[model samples]
Target: MALWILCLLVVLGMGFNMVSGQGEDPFGPEGGRRREMVPAMFIFGDSLIDNGNNNDLPSFAKANYFPYGIDFNGGPTGRFSNGYTMVDEIAELLGLPLIPAYSEASGDQVLHGVNYASAAAGILDITGRNFVGRIPFDQQIRNFQNTLDQITDNLGAVDAAQALARCIFFVGMGSNDYLNNYLMPNYPTRNQYNGQQYADLLVQQYTQQLKTLYNLGARKFVLAGLGRMGCIPSILAQSTAGSCSEEVNQLVLPFNANVKAMLNSLNVNLPGARFIYIEIAHLFEDLIANSKIYGFSVVNRACCGIGRNRGQITCLPFQTPCENRDQYVFWDAFHPTEKVNIIMARKAFNGDTSIVYPMNIEQLANIDIEPN
Candidate 1:
């Protein structure tokens, strides 16, 4: 009887060990089992979520150097922010690992998803020509196609198509199209189109681009609208008082409105489409208006740049960022710190209706979809 009892006790202990050693799932809540909300995430945008895609590109906008990633675990990885970007935070909330840049991703890395964003890129191909080398939205889409082809080769056409339809395509382009193209005095875009006309042109082009993505098996999309461009440190620095340029803000308002309307049209036109529009401008205005509530003391200044508001020049090599990085909203002339990124991502993922409309990322990820 004693021997039988010992054997039973040992078996119970082994079973307990096995359960404990299985580890908690990173996809679920803390100490919960791992489960993927979506099959993967395919990111497309500009500097806001470039990750390391621009590192190897012959672009002056690259950030894979010192002082850029001081707060990130892996160091400067071509992300404009000091740490993670909004997408990085969103990926964490979705229970996935950091999405690799398309420039460096290969084989299985493409399965989890890939970041095709390039710093200084815009919806228009000619937008960032001054940057010398940047992958525009068109090329980024092509890169994604190549990735899709590889996935198809690996998993067969049917499986690859199904996997892609279940993934999330997060797009945050167009800001540079305005800032780096239309608003830049050196560019002729402004000459060709007025503010409203330019907005219309962008929407026309963007509408077609999104349709291309839909055709490529992207069913779930999180399209981030443009933030207040005039409020960023770079634009504010243009003012002696370091105040936001209301005119610039007005310039992009129509674009944001058009984008939201376009998404609505797309949802109706495309079958099985689930599009979530992130009200970035509204969220940004709220954070700026209630900085103290968000624990930010300085929203007008860049944490690591030169001149007034740190907006005159971007973070140069070896530039020492402010000691209290989290207290500042702007990481450089244009980007947000990791803390701000986290806040924005969290809000976009699961915040109330004001920040994210037509359902948040969490909702978009979990919604039922027919297999493609």
Candidate 2:
């Protein structure tokens, strides 16, 4: 009995380490700086980067179960990443816990932040319907407004406004609008309109959507632009005998460039409504150009299941899993590794945003506080 107890304890100890990040935060904001007040972070987007809203729905793209969270959290917490996501990292920077998924019943526990993002969702509803019945961006807004009302109804309008005014909203979607929605289906008018025209329509709708959110009290926005989809294992597999499709790259460039322009236009329109774009293209490119520099040994393969898209072919209850997940750069064909999301999130806030705009999430969150 004594020997059995000792062995049980040993296994439990290792399990605990795998969960709660071995009781240590990989990116705990302790590099000689930290925020004073906690800021709310609201997120909206798709599966290439969902933090768990899809778990609420009956979809295959969902990532709210076991084995998915084996790396960092030890158990599944609905996050799409192996553990934490970009939104989680951003919330940590603000001294807040991970943002709750909208599908969760405990949004009130972390009322300051909530994620309406669903895996496979997109800017347009058509894109979401392409893969699964995802919560469209517009519906995500409805959920956000409802969440605000929940706080206001209980805490009163003044308190709710005060809570939201200091909030930070991060939007990281649009890939599906091109991938599953416009380009893939039977030739539609949008597809024939050329990349520039298609991007314009997307920007117009996106701009209108953000304006609507601002009207509802969104002050700060961190928009994550199109990630490196051309470099995805799935897209690469579609090429001639395992090569990256340059055609995919050709399609992605115009959309990304247009997003930058539209973001600039939105910032110009909204006063005191600061906007920052998280450039994911170059980030992924770095992973390919120099893998060691970005901490990814395998730049194009996924770590789960089997086949080109990493079990996406037969991704179900009985698929086989890869032995070493840490060796791969992707968790699935479309999404990134948990470690990579951390790097991208850190760079988004601390690196170029500071240089590109002379301000960042760190500075904005700490604007009202005096240095200690």
Candidate 3:
């Protein structure tokens, strides 16, 4: 009985290590710099990962204001969260510097990376029309192509292809397609197709979008799947019972599943492709299910919004957020707290197949691909 109990305890410890990292820091010893895992990391996504790409655009999804960056070093650089984003944390783990937004990047900054992620961006062109001036996924891809053109100009085609082949392309999209398009009463997406049909359509377009990036010399890819949208503060605010809307949760499952299958197919079909999927939905589910274990006390309300559940609207310009920001699961109506982002990023960096599929970011970065 004693031996059996010890074995059970060891198994439980391993599981916890998988969820929360194994306490390994990718950063090296004190006073010494570790070599970056990849040459650069290009980001493509929406508000969840948008550093400041939408600040200049005439869009309602901007977050360049007080309280938004209260916890960050430089105040409110247009990140939608209180501090670092998941991509930011991932960048640090890869030993790369914080990538600048494409709108702000210039000169040698492009050598490291450029974030083309924009607030309210989506898989479909018209997904965020309500926000007006927001860049969609297709436009973001064009922006990447523009960056590639400049890289080729500087390094020449051969060196540019080799450099890009070693860089990591991190793409997190599709959230806004549901949040601001299909789910919105003002949009015609729901009327045009049901949930399953819409998922297929989005995945079809998404596959092509990824292929374009691949053709442009991207070899390593980290595609983040959509999370549990129903539990977000915005969706919860619409719930009459102050609980998660199962219908909303059910609506996004097909999209995640289809994306996973798509990634597998891409890896097999696309030459030199190393595509990995991040289980955002499963991570969110585990975090919410074991909130206390993760130190999140407030899971249902926003830390800085107005109206019911503090989610009727996102944070106002100078609104003061909760004092215990780290204890809250969400920072605003549609985004997770920086703490949650940290957890997700760390898991993706070193966790097993359960969190990041086929292989983790650390493994992906270390992959030795022959120049093609």
Candidate 4:
């Protein structure tokens, strides 16, 4: 029965792509001459925005096959969502083609941008160690350095540097560091540090990481703060009444506060750095609290997976997803459906100061880069 559903999903995706003229450029005329909001986009994070960088890795943290991309035009291109991820929508809004996965990208594909997000990855190397074969945040930065070298080889060093300055560097990470590492019993992180202390350690490391990016010519950045981790399907499932774990939610508040402070400090110290913090916690809470307003009937249940809330287990190889995919906020045990992803991306692109503090992506994109 599960296999049958999987087959149907693939057929549906293929048919949709065929009818929608997916191959043809949806942005504009030929020669990649579309008017873009930014020169390019460099993505760094986890599965929430991973395109297909994990497909070739010897890792269990993969979504390269089956119902993963059941609603996407390309079909199971390793995005955890049933369709496009937030980054995909953000790219479209920026008038650029979807950023290619760094592992599979080359030639002109790298010109637009590259995604370094890996499923199960985190800010710390040991955060997702249980998954194995994952690229930690540090490695993702190194990969970006390699991409910079490649860009320099193609365009001259001066032009490549200018392009880098004009591009957007988006980072949506840290969730797995808390969820997969600190919370897991097998890990010694919890034994070493309490909630506040752990958050401090993570932020301390994160500060250096963003600084590294700044030194590497990343000027425009969008750092997405951790959302309401307790409200996620996986966390809710841990409760007998399916209520959110306040303890888990409280753990993330400090991290978010620290991240905001870090961004403010970076902006002051880095001179040219323009870092925008996306208040994901508030945005996610609004969606969950006012599901009906967002046209979602099921805010807690996942569209895929098994057991209560369809979250006790993740979406398996042949699992059937929900029929009304748009009604559910989550696509799997850990990720949001494409519908919600689009909503989040739209808000991050042009939302008010409450959601995107200081300025939104559209405002940041339009800011002219003044050379040092």
Give the per-residue Cα lDDT of candidate 4 at 295: 90
Estimate every model's Cα lDDT from 0 to 1. 0.83, 0.65, 0.85, 0.83
Collision pairs in model 2: 47-120
lDDT of 1: 0.83
Q: What residue pairs are clashing in model 3?
A: none
Poorly placed runs, candidate 1 (over 4 Å): 1-33, 153-156
Total clashes for model 3 = 0
Provide backbone clash counts, one per model.
1, 1, 0, 0
TM-score of 2: 0.82
Candidate 4 residue lDDT tens string, 132-158: 888889999988776555535544555
Q: Write the per-residue lDDT of candidate 2 for residues 241-312, one digit (tens) a residue.
A: 666767777777887787788778777777667677777887777667877766567777776645765523
Residue 319 error, candidate 3, Å: 0.7
Tens-digit per-residue lDDT, 172-215, candidate 3: 99999999999999998999999999999999999999999998
Residue 42 displacement (Å), model 4:
0.3
Per-model TM against the reference: 0.90, 0.82, 0.91, 0.90
- Model 3: residues with Cα > 4 Å off, grouped in runs: 1-32
Q: What is the lDDT of candidate 2?
A: 0.65
- Shift of residue 92 alpha carbon in model 4, Å: 0.4
